[model samples]
Target: MSAITLEIDGNKVQVTDGMTVLEAADNAGIFIPTLCHHDKLEPFGGCRLCIVEVEERGWTKMVVSCVYLAAEGLVVRTRSDKVDRIRKTILELLLAHAPDAEVLKELAQEYGADKDRFEKDPSFCIHCGLCVRYCAEVKQKFAVGFVDRGIRKEISFIPEIAARECNACKECFPLCPTSYLQAAFVLTESLAFPAQQKKSE
Candidate 1:
């Protein structure tokens, strides 16, 4: 395969053609923050957290590095004051929407974001679709699908009750970027199976 040379954070790096900016950064030891992207799955470009300033057509524009393929002579800036501020704002917004989301909280803390300017929403789920994608594409189980649209959309198994088409494989739960599914499972198991056994007659 051919190689593409790009400048990332003023560092010259060469990556295989068709590789995304994020992949090139990884190879070059430059860290780029991301939330909706996973190495095991295809880039969905849902979250703008991985946004990077790219020099294109003589203009620098913010682009999601996970989905934007690196090209020869491409200039990519992964870290800059503008990029950092944007990333912090995005993390803050996501945290406000899902305060209890551990993964989101960690990301916010990582970026030193201490305040959430946006109004808080009780409903969780940032709508990254990691769970849905993992189930359908990786696990080959289309048991769960997103219901409703926009703000009301959420992931749930078919029938919503009947034995859960989940197959109890625990695949979707782990792939979820947020802690919602995994936390719920732990709570359910604790309630369903009490550690202390009752005295038998």
Candidate 2:
């Protein structure tokens, strides 16, 4: 494979061709924070947390590092004031939508986000699509897909059925980026804790 040289955070590094900016940063020991991006799956620029400023041919633009292909002579800034603001805003929006999600909470904390300025709707999905992608790509089941559009978009197993031909694989649960598929588990645990405490009393 051919090699591509790029400047990441002002440090020169050479990586294999066809590598994404995120992969190159990882190879160079630069940590670019991301959500909705997993090493085991193909890159999907849903979260926008990995946004970086890249300079190419005298022009610079913010691009999601996970999906942007790294090229020779590319100058990348993994973290900047603009990138930080974008990440914080994205996290804030995600937290507002899924406030009960521990994963989202942790990510928000990392960005020092304390409050959401926007109205939160608990019923909507963040639309990361990790569940559907995992089922289709990783599990090879193709059991689920996105239905509807915009805020109405959601993952469904099939037509008119709440469950898909999932093969009982349980792969989607862990891979879900927004914890939508595991909300039941968290709720059940929270409910059980109170009852268990009463039982001990």
Candidate 3:
């Protein structure tokens, strides 16, 4: 892979081809907050918190850093008034689902997002997909996954797979950003969502 040079938060960064803006930022030690991105898993932009303003050829546009490919001569601003505003709004929406999620609260403080900005809909899952992806991609065990779609989407553990695989491989549990999410604080979360724990039946 050829080296691509870009600027992130005014710091010059050199990264290889096919690298995402978020990876470039990480290599340069630029902190771009993200919830849906994990080093061991493929880039998942489920949480738009890593959104950044990319200015290339004088046209500035916002893109999710985790999935946006880094390009030569790209000027990436990880934080700005506009970016902050967008993050605040996204945080507010996510906060509505997991109001007590410590990660959201900390990011909300940085972005001035009111946790109460939106009415609580508290499904308790922010849909970051960390557990789902980690289990499938890293562990090669499809124990936990999302069920339903759109607003009704929620995470569930596969009873049989989770029973056999997850009991010993609970690595994805800590990856959840929603701390104390309902009963997710422990392995018993598998029992909490017995409704959809899939494919294992």
Candidate 4:
């Protein structure tokens, strides 16, 4: 594959084919905030913090840098009024869900996002899909997944398999930014596997 040249934050960057905008920006030493992205794991664009503005086909549009593939002659802006507004909005919303997450709080502070802008929710999961993707991609367990959609969307342990896999696999715990999975691991009875079920027995 041919190397592609693109502009990120007014700096020219060269990346190989099949590289995402996030990777390209990283190659250029540009920093794009992200929550759900892991270098070892696949690109999961759950958090919109890495969004960038690009001009494509004469139309300016916002796109997620983590999954948006880099192309030749693409002009990308990692920071701008529009990009900051959208990223701050996303951080604020995430704060509502994970208020106790120190990582989230710090990011909100950096972005000047108002954590109190939205009503607080009991949920602590940011729905970054890190745990889910980690289980499937790295752990190869496929023991957890997402359920429902919209605001109701949640991470659900695959009951039948979760009862067999989750308790032994603690790898995803450290990968979570919020450390919210610790609470879920201890509290979610419905997702309990044999090890947890033994506590009741």
Candidate 5:
């Protein structure tokens, strides 16, 4: 692949073709916050946390770096007042769901996100879909899925498929950004082996 040169945060970065702005920035050692992005998975842009300002066609516009392709002669600003405001807002929303996530907490602190900006929500999963994507794309299990829409959307395990497959393969455990999946796994195991639970106690 031919290398494409782009300017990120005032630094010239040369990256292979088909690389996203986020990947280019990462190659150049520029920090762009993201939640719904994992190197192992395709960019979903669910969290909208990696928004950056880019000069395109003489117009500066905010775009999510994780999905925006890097191009030659492109000027990107990873951090700016507008970008910071957008990222902080996204962080605040994520904290409402994954307050205990150390990754989220640290990123929130770095971006000066207000932990209390939004009302506390009981849900812990940020719904970044990492686990869902990992299960379907990488694991090929399709045991879980997102149900509902918008705020009502959530990860729901299909009991028949999940019970049959999830017990044997907890492959999506490490991909979750919150403890909700871990707790769910423990609950599933305890329910599956009540005898083991009693024996342990």
Candidate 6:
């Protein structure tokens, strides 16, 4: 593939074609924070933590670097006062769901985000879709999926498939930002997959 040159935080980088700005920045040794991006999965851009400023042809706009395609002559700024403010707001929103997540805590410190900025919700999931996508894309299990929508949306395991596939393939558990995947799995085992639970016991 041909090379694409771009400027990330004043550092010129040449990356392979089809690489996203996040990947390009990473290869160039520039730090860009992200919550919903993983190398093994397609770009989901759910967390909005890798937002960056891109300027080309005298126009500037903000985009999630994980999904934004890298291009020749593109100018990217991973962090600016405006970028930090946006990230701080996103972190504050996520922190409300997972106040104790160490990853969020560290980013919150860097961006000055208050964990209590939003009202507390019992669900600790930030809804990054890591587990859902990993199970479907990488594992091909389709065991876990999303339920509901908008304000009420959350992840859930489909007990029929999960009961048979999850325990043996718990690879996605560690990808959770708040460790909520394990809890969700345990709850599903108790509530949705009770037949299997009783048999196992």
In the range 160-188, model 4's lDDT, one tens digit per residue, is: 77666666677888888888776666656
Tens digits of per-residue lDDT, candidate 1, 1-201, equal 898899999999999998999999999999887767887889998778999999966889899999999999999998888888889988888877677677777777877775456788855677787877877788766655678988777665553321343435777676666666555444444454323212111
Candidate 5 residue 73 Cα shift, in angstroms, is: 1.0
lDDT of each: 0.76, 0.76, 0.85, 0.85, 0.84, 0.92
What does candidate 5's lDDT look like per residue over 117-146, in tens digits?
Answer: 899895887888888998888888888888
TM-scores vs. true structure, each candidate: 0.83, 0.82, 0.90, 0.89, 0.89, 0.95
After TM-score superposition, what is the CA distance of residue 30 in candidate 4 from its true location, in Å? Answer: 1.2
Pairs of residues clashing in candidate 2: none
| Best model per TM-score | 6
For model 1, the superposed segments whose C-alpha errors exceed 4 Å read: 160-167, 183-201
Please provide, for model 6 over 1-201, each residue's C-alpha lDDT reduced to its tens digit, 9 standing for 90 to 100. Answer: 999899999989999999999999999999899989999999999999999999988899999999999999999999899999999999998988899998999999999999888998758889999999999999999999999998899998898899889877799989998999999999999997777767767
Indicate the residue-level lDDT of 8 in model 5.
89
Flag the better candidate by lDDT, 3 or 6: 6
Clashing residue pairs for model 1:
none
TM-score of 4: 0.89
Q: Name the 10 consecutive residues with the lowest summed lDDT in model 5.
A: 191-200
Off by over 4 Å in 5: 187-201
Candidate 2 lDDT, 1-201, residue by residue in tens: 899899999999999999999999999999998767777789988878889999999999999999999999999998788888888888888777777777777877877775466787775467777877786788777656788988777666542222333323566777776567665333433454445434535
The segments of candidate 3 whose C-alpha lies over 4 angstroms from its true place after superposition are 180-201
Is 1 or 2 the stronger prediction by TM-score?
1
Best by lDDT: 6
